[model samples]
Target: MDRTARILQDLYDSEINFTIATFWHAGFQIKLGLGDEVNGFDATGTADNLVDAVEWLRVQAIKKYPESVFATNYRR
Candidate 1:
């Protein structure tokens, strides 16, 4: 599967409630929901809080995955 899909799968597998905001025609980004915070890396390449990790993924989507659509305010 693609990176985004893989990441989403991983997140779900970890029992975390991941919220995905899709940017059609581009790539999609995922954010971890409340109480789903696990002290580990997520599918979005995060190694801590899902918020931080998803933000990192958004950055990566913009920089690395140019064609990828992502969410805004990855920092917070």
Candidate 2:
């Protein structure tokens, strides 16, 4: 598969739940949601590339849930 497909597959396989939207002529936006039903948080990141967008969202997720499995596994 191509790089974009691979990255998307990896994201889908991860525990983190997210949605991505593409702008007409701007770029891309990703909205990532973390935490359980009782406690939840949402973060949005926009970038010209998917990698940058995911990285931005990942940083936000790590900051909010430093001890979470997603953060721990992401570091490795």
Candidate 3:
């Protein structure tokens, strides 16, 4: 799979909900939605590459779910 697909799979495996959009000249836009509607935290960021996008998502996930395994076991 491509890097972006791999990144998305990792997020799925980690039980993180996300959406990624690509723009011709603007790189990638990543949005991660965590938890339920009423108490959820949503994080959005733009990156020039998939790796950075996932890293940003990881940081946000950790911030919202400090006790989650995602904090320690997230893959690069």
Best by TM-score: 3
The TM-scores, one per candidate, come to: 0.33, 0.62, 0.66
Q: List the residue pairs that clash in candidate 1.
A: 27-68, 27-69
lDDT of each: 0.45, 0.66, 0.71
Candidate 1 backbone clash number: 2
Model 3 ranges off by over 4 Å: 1-7, 35-41
Top model by lDDT, which number? 3
Q: Give model 1's TM-score versus the native structure.
A: 0.33
lDDT of 1 by residue, 1-76 (tens): 8655665564455444555555555455554432434653234432344445555544544443333323222222
lDDT (tens digit, per residue) of candidate 2 on 10-70: 5566666666779788888777765543565377678897778767666766666677665
RMSD of each: 12.6, 4.0, 3.5
C-alpha positional error of residue 17 in candidate 2 after TM-score superposition, expressed in Å? 1.8
Error of 1 at 17 (Å): 0.9
Q: Model 3, range 1-76, lDDT digits (tens) per residue?
A: 9755665676678787876679888988877776544665477789997688877777777776666666566533
lDDT of predicted model 1: 0.45
Better of 2 and 3 by lDDT: 3
In model 3, pairs of residues that clash are none
